[model samples]
Target: MKRLLFIIALFVVPAFALEIQNLRVVPKNIDAGNVTRIMFKLSGPAKLSINVKGLNGASVTSLISNVLYPAGQFSIPWKTPKKIESGYYIPVITAVDQISGESVTKQIETRTAKMISLPFTTSDLPGGNKEISYSIDKAALVSIRVGINNGPMYKIISNWELTQPGAYSVKWDGWDGDHVIKVDQLANYLIDIKYIPVEIDALYVTNPKNISKKTIVPASEILRQINAFVPKYSVAVSNKKIASNSKNNESINLDINVDDNTLEELGDIPYEYVLYIDGKRYGEIENTTSPYNWEISTKNLSKGSHVFTLMICTSIEQINTRSFKVTL
Candidate 1:
């Protein structure tokens, strides 16, 4: 199986606008494949074009272009790039004087998610330092835990962090310093990882994409703690329940299978894929032709956020929508 990592980007309030002021992206730290909302207030009627540009100073995506609006506050939703490889970006908002056709531009720099391919895998065993190689494109905190015989995995080793690009092996003896581990004591082994995702937008995401409606967290606090690890972002797929520190826990492997009826219904039809998180629209793939196989990894989502996938069949007008709630 192929492994994938999740990420996001930073956003900020744009430079001053004569007719427009306080141009900012809501949930400033937008995850890969998720949407961020941009808001601003107008002093008078104006024509505006809100576009996100790549590093080459070229327009990547235009959220709003040449649209006229009355003097008032408004929000425009902007989608981040779907892929992690898209590096840093800038959001530029321009206003044209309705009567003169002259324009003013305001821009702000932001970060984007990066992907990492790790050498740590299912093959790493619990003998001595189970040597595993890994590398990252940017500074990141990587957390690794070990499990034995389909039982609870212990966070035996972590904090072997990386901030630069290089290849190296991190040895793990499979002990939490409080416990000892042996290779032959179990029937199967499991490993899990949780890394502080690279801040694609800023050093800290003052505003999380799924911000609490009632809770008010200051920007400074979010920035100071942005690099800290969040467990809701942890990734682990296993057939057995993670063993706890308690004694006498039995090990069992769980298998997942689909019925023939379900398999038959799984065939693809022509459709479009729309991704939304917490009731906000983010990414869309138009005309996903036959074989209708497309994928979006929400590994970057915070705990308690809801991911909605809408697959609309164009031929017969059938809509299949799935909503996944992240429980942690």
Candidate 2:
């Protein structure tokens, strides 16, 4: 009888030595915006209990109740704290085996979420126009507001429009209440938009195209030779000296002097003169009569050198030339 009891004791002692096996955390690292899961298996047939302790001594009870299994294979999930202080957290999982009174523990370290920064800014569209756009780094919830300096707050032209998180565009037609914005008053306008942190590379406000001249010229026979220079060049001379008249305060004057030798080839039709500065078309003049002359004052031109182009054309052909040093 004593020998039989010794054999049973040996078997029982070995069963009590059961250990944890195949322990794994579903996701090794948890990002700031995500959840984590952990799982593990044990060796003996027994009822098991689990307890998890955080590094800071905060303990979370096992979501699963005492579970019966031949071999203790278990899984548990825990929600990470939302506002996690930046630091490492160690999780201790302890499993108690009911049958053999054996306990096994495992530990895992979890990293906290990180802070994010974004670059962003706001600016006006080109031509000092009323339109505006916002640029940001990533797509996310955005809040934008605009107001005159120290004035009452108002929604951006269309409330906070969800922009494509990167480069985005918005436009504001020149209007405040019942007042329409005068072209001259557009410069003093101010716009403000705010958004989450993002890197803003640049912002720009554009002004209207400052035209310097505008005029019309007649198609002539000799002028046809000039029109043959280039295909599109004809159109360049067709519309001469068309400018805004606001940028140039100078008088629009024209003089035409043709040599008698070239007059016959020029025929009854006179060479038409067209001028433009800075891509704007100025008016034109026809050299129908000898020493033809015309003059008008400019409005927007500042005292400086502006681009000037002269096109001489007839109905069939046209010739054009450009000079850059024309002073206002």
Per-prediction CA RMSD (Å): 21.7, 28.0
* lDDT of each candidate versus the true structure: 0.46, 0.44
Clashes of 2: 53
- Candidate 2, poorest ten consecutive residues by summed lDDT: 213-222
Report the lDDT tens digits of candidate 1 across residue range 24-93.
6677555567777777777766788888764345567888889988878988776564553323445688
Q: 255-324, model 2: which lDDT tens digit per residue?
A: 4444454455455554676555543567677645654554645566677766544445555423334333
Scored against the true structure, residue 153 in model 1 reaches a CA lDDT of: 38
Runs in model 1 deviating more than 4 A are 1-17, 84-86, 109-328
How many residue pairs collide in each prediction? 9, 53
lDDT of 1: 0.46
lDDT of 2: 0.44
TM-score of 2: 0.26
On lDDT, the leading prediction is 1
